[model samples]
Target: MDLPRSFTIRESSHRILNPFTDEKLATLGRALHLAPGTRMLDLACGKGEMLCTWAAAHRVTGTGVDISSDFIGAASARAAALGVADQVTFLHDDAASHAATDPVDVASCIGATWIGGGVAGTVELLRRSLRPGGTMLVGEPYWRREPPDQAAVEGSMATSKDEFRSLPALIEQFGELGVDVVEMVLADQDSWDRYVAAQWLNIRRWLDRNPDDELAEQMRAELTTAPVRYARYQRDYLGWGVFVLMDR
Candidate 1:
């Protein structure tokens, strides 16, 4: 299945779909010390920004799989623009069903761990495609602090606090899964603001251009209240990062 139309509309301008800025992503690519011929398998690789950029910067070859045809098209275009078309392939397919023909040096499920149900399951899924001593990248959200109330939970877009662990607990989880935390690039408040606040502008611009669109009203409502919700709950309660892991 493809991403919801509203989500695509809200995030149409985003090159990287997660709460990661271009600089932070670049830092991660460099920190990995990827060799010239490193191979990567990225599931739910939104817009292929990471793969295309890494291929250009590190000479890494990779395959990116996603369910959205529109996103896949954008990703393909990105690869070409970055002069890495030959180094990366983008497939419009369900990540859960995709398999690598060969093991990869890095396997990732960035910001979409739901592909394998959750963090633990996503790790297992990525492991299947990774070579021994390879890295695994998992992008996920954890609680920055305990939510003090139900409104806080709802504001964080979670049904309950059980949905996410605290940051330290999340690290423990990686250990429990038999992986060592190697490196991480976490989102700061500014990065979060950039990612979340951008939706309002995109939605507002869309509403202005497509006043009669069927989803216009829904997006308008989101634009109206999302900021308040974010400031009150999400900005302080949620922490997100792409954690680098290697099997212990």
Candidate 2:
């Protein structure tokens, strides 16, 4: 079973797919207090960069689950390349109904909450794979301030202005869900640029290689407009972050 070629291409280059830059990712790792022997599960783990790097750097053992086999293969290679093959595993699987092979210290569904519908639902979904006292890590979007216009919301990838709450409201929602927001790492403008702008180069290269592909037109449109849209709307009105949570 093959995903759309565009999806495969994006999955193959997730260091750029993600909205967080490498420095932000490292900051997140430190904020989570990830350590040796910590068992973790990464849902929607694109290319498993975070999992593999954390495994090697912190000596953590983890499993990364993604829908793309290409991502799983790349993740496996990354683990081995980092000499942490024994510590991390990658699987091509659906994450919506994923169950941990065993209870783990951390369960993460970063930047892909659609697997559980949305943020609150995703937290519940991650809870199932976590040990009694384990943490749930979610990377999600919020508003820097309430969007002043529907177009601004659309630019941030939401259908309506109500799709995401403001940052404090997002944290409060987690509290209402009975989870303590223990740690968080926010994405800065530069990080967002890295995530969105880098895609332009990849898309440009793809169009060069596969000029006749049907998706090429759509990607070209995105490439032409995304940078301006992102700068005008998302950069000014939206925010993104990864939160580390624990049961209250």
Candidate 3:
């Protein structure tokens, strides 16, 4: 009931596991005009940065569910540190099956659409937890440009180019689902670099301390090649953003 060991280790120091920076996250909260006590449900909520920060800044209260125990622990600690422990909660559970107990002002699943299979399914899953006129936040990757070939796709860690739609087509996807894309904030290449490059340093520091760990070899290989692969493909061809959606 957790993410792979490699993933947790690589992102051990990350508060926000995705490309969305703290500033971008704050901007998103402000853009939403969150009212005090706004109830939110964040699936795959990682370290619960959104809930904790929103609770502190916007006075929103929320629950975050993530399968990773390590992440859940960190999230709880974060809430406590922010002195918002009373406003938010984190549960270590499989988000795919964690049904919301109450309707919420917002339901979000960021960077983990696989919980319901894909973007459309994930959107429906979140929508089920929303109150009338409530919003859904979906963080997804889009193809910024057509990859030149298979190498580009593989380099971006995608099985195929079809895995992501272009930005315009992505909006159309929301249209197909009867939702309006009311707002969005995109991640630029610098943010992508910060998110991906930080992993190399984390792995390197861990390798320095635990040279004989079982995953060391895999981590070493990943660190060795990630920079080139990321700069060449992911930074240029992949675009990620969190879209704010509401029914039409």
All models, RMSD in angstroms: 0.8, 1.5, 0.7
Q: Count the backbone clashes (under 3 Å) in each candidate.
A: 0, 0, 0
Error of 1 at 111 (Å): 0.6
User: Each model's C-alpha lDDT?
Assistant: 0.94, 0.84, 0.93
TM-score of each: 0.98, 0.95, 0.99
Assess candidate 3 and give its TM-score to the true structure: 0.99
Q: What is the lDDT of residue 186 in candidate 1?
A: 98
| Tens-digit per-residue lDDT, 1-248, candidate 3 | 67899988899889999998888999999999999999999999999999999999999999999999999999999999999999999999999988688899999999999998999999889988999899999999999999989999999889999999999999999999999999999998888888988888999999999899999899899889998999889999999999999987
lDDT of 2 by residue, 100-186 (tens): 968999999988999999988899889889999999999888988788888888988789987888899999999999999999998
Cα deviation of 131 in candidate 1 (Å)?
Answer: 0.9
Model 1 error, position 78 (Å): 0.7
**Measured by C-alpha RMSD in angstroms, how accurate is candidate 2?**
1.5
Candidate 3 lDDT (Cα, 0 to 1): 0.93
- Candidate 3 error regions (>4 Å): none
Q: List model 1 lDDT by residue over 135-167, tens digit each.
A: 999999999989999999999989999999999
